[model samples]
Target: MSLDQAAAVMEQQARACRNMAAPLYADLLVHTAEDVRAGGPCADAVAGWTGAPSTAAVPLRLLGGVHALVLTGQAPQLARFYPSAGGAYRPEDADAAWAAFRAVVADRRDAVRGWLRRPPQTNEVGRANLLLAGLLHAVQESRGLPVRLVELGASAGLNLRADRFRVAAPGFAWGPEDSPVRLPGAWRDGVPGWLREAARSYPELTVVERLGCDVTPLDPGSEDGALALRAYLWPEHTARATRLGGALELARRVPARVDRVGAAEFLAGLDPRPGTLTVVWHSVMRQYVPADEWARVTAELDRLAAAGAPFAHLLFEPYEQDGRHRFQLRARIGAGPERVLAEAHPHGLPAWTV
Candidate 1:
């Protein structure tokens, strides 16, 4: 890279790392620079290098794009590359940080060309909800009772409508014969049906609370709120965008309201009412919560569990495994043992129960 090119890269890196503490950013930059030099995916993407390069540019650009879209809600020229339906270029419609990076590169022209040629894969939003349903079933089985779920990071609160919104795993062979979110396989057959039936048996099994916690909570009632929900979507997941729209409509119909609050503080104050089967569930929420806040949340939960609190908690997290994203389901009671219930695709296509 030329001196100017190197300087530009450094400047971008500095800005990207600014959110972290200064000391942390310095160390992170050093390690990240080394990782890029070693041909990491991050490095290649930013430098506009081609064919099996690093992905460093990816996170910065994507995150930046999301921020840009969230802030502006305007048409991004970068949308040409991603080509998502439903106003993908409009920042306010969806999360733009990732999308903006492409536009940012488009302006760069000289340095980021090669990297911008290919867009990152969309995170499968639909699959994520499917995994949550199975996790709910597993938790129900463990507790020996129907579950009343309370969700954190509810997003548009679509997953909370699992029963009402029809779903099918086109990629797998397990689920209802007539489903709305049709994918590529036969239904997982037995348990899913049983769970569905059980779900129906209790029409009055209301979600005591299907609330969410967002530093910036999204209220579907507002146009901007709808856009923020759009900004987070990856362009490749058309099905998800469709489903999100549907969920948004459902949310309007029932309006599953989310309480904007700190997760740790929220849980701390929540004394699950006696005899109520409360399941404190979080799906893909831990990553966003700050480390200190996360520690506090866990600590509070531990205190509740120690008291033999009448709550069954389920966590559905998608993490990288062998260069791919996969979901894991684990259940715990207060500080009790966290039992690993299943591991599957981040989307609901494939899953193996423990």
Candidate 2:
């Protein structure tokens, strides 16, 4: 890519980070994009990143590498700007931090390049609240049948243990109150009557099978895996980091199998079981899937739904509405039309019931 084109992508990512409530990342990425244009270490690290702009996610991957260095105590100067290292994020310190970041990249070119080559796996546990809300809605509609969940792009499969996490809205709550992963005040508005009823009727779901697929899955039990997962989270978001730690602990006790396969390939091999609700779910992952493969995934979903078995497809993804980006919880059960359950935060908190 041309220097101008690369800079444009970085600038676009910076804007997105700012909109997504990650000012620290926005400042660093904005500076990194300028450094790229000026022919420096930042540009060298991101060299050969040929993915399309929409699917690149290059900025986060680069940031993750830097964060890893900071976490490992390899970049002490840069650590002062990272909240995860017990430092405060001041916008005025961003310029000095960027210089330190460039120096780190220059000194650790090989390590940074390795990170850029790998796809980012955040494995956000907070999103499980929104995913569980969708599952509860489906369970209620299916009349409390045991659910067999199949998740695409499951990352570390941390969310497979979502049922074990607690969530609280204004007037309703679900899961164990004493659970390690607690999502207090999860919803933006008052919980809907349907959700309340579902939570009341079934405080916990009967999940017979928990299976997930990802082209590259991380093992939450491994030290390297845990480090990589934590590195992707913005240092400023302490709640998210804490939640991830809890989810990792949960994963140790209750293990979920995540297959190393693409989404379409995994779906093609799945067969819905009788006397159980077969639910296919994904969150914030559809954007990474290619159009042709996603089309195949949709066809497979339709085929599974038509097999005379109880089935549901749930998604938490961004949908453009009225010229704005809104992440929505949508579901399709059996042959029924799609339903928009709620609008949610990207990290899966503060859901507004619709």
Candidate 3:
């Protein structure tokens, strides 16, 4: 691809970052876009890329790479501009911060390019809020049956331990008070009556099993794996970083296994047991799966449903509805029809009924 084309891709992602309240990444991305257009180090970092920009998330890959450099102490000059590294991004010092970021990309050119080869790996813990909500709905529908939780594209299997995380919203509260991962203000407007009642009725969840699949599963217990997860976080958002820290810490105490396999392959081997409710769930990772493979996944889900052995399918993914992109929490139980339980933020916060 031409340098100008790549630069445009960077600019597009910059707009996204701005919209998502990541001023640090937005500023860096905008400056990097200019560098790419000027055929500077940023251009070389993304040279010869030929995929749909949004699909590849090229800008995020590059920024995450640079963030890793700071986190790992490879680019100390850039660390001061990154909050995740105990530094701050000041609007008044934008030029100086850009200079530091540019220098890092130029010096660590190969490292930035290495990151471009891999897609962004962000297993956002905030999304667990929505997933847990769906799981609770599933449990309630299945009459308090012990759940066999299965996740597709669960990066670190962190959300597999969603049951253990503390969740609080208007008229709704659950999980251990002393839990490390605490999701507060979950529903923006007001807690849906159904969810509130479900939370009250169940009060606690019993997850008898936790298994997930990713093409390349990351071990949250490993130093490199944990660092990668942290590196991908936008430096300015301390809350996100804090939540991830807690999830990583919790991963050590919890036993959630993520196998290395395609989603369809993983689901193909499973069938619902009589006693436990098999809840198949995924969040934000649906776009990564190809349509044909997803067809297989749906087929597998249908097979489980037909088996009629206390099965549930839960999804917290984006959908085009009501003339806008909606991030929805949808669920179905046994042979029941699927329905949207609620709509939520992409990172799974502040949910409201559809």
Judged by lDDT, which candidate is best? 2
Worst 10 residues of 3 by lDDT: 47-56
lDDT of 3 by residue, 226-320 (tens): 98898888998889889899998899999998999999999999989998999999999889999999999999999999996999999999999
Whole-model lDDT, candidate 1? Answer: 0.51
Error of model 2, residue 182, in angstroms = 1.4
Q: Which stretches of candidate 3 lie over 4 Å from their true place?
A: none
TM-score of each: 0.60, 0.97, 0.97
lDDT of each: 0.51, 0.88, 0.87
Please give the lDDT score at residue 126 for candidate 2.
79
Cα deviation at 292, candidate 1, in Å, is 2.5
Candidate 2 residue-wise lDDT, 1-354, digit = tens: 676688788889899889887888899889888988888888888877734474778888899998998999999998998888887778888888888988999999999888887788888887887888889999998999999988999999999989999998766778987788999878886887778888888888889989999999999999999999999999889888989999999999987999999999999999889899999999999999999999999999998989989999999999988998899999999978989999888888888887
What value does the lDDT take at residue 346 in candidate 1?
A: 50
- Judge candidate 2 at residue 254 and give its lDDT: 86
TM-score of 3: 0.97
The parts of candidate 1 lying over 4 Å away from their true place are: 1-82, 86-131, 142-147, 169-205, 307-309, 318-326, 333-336, 347-349
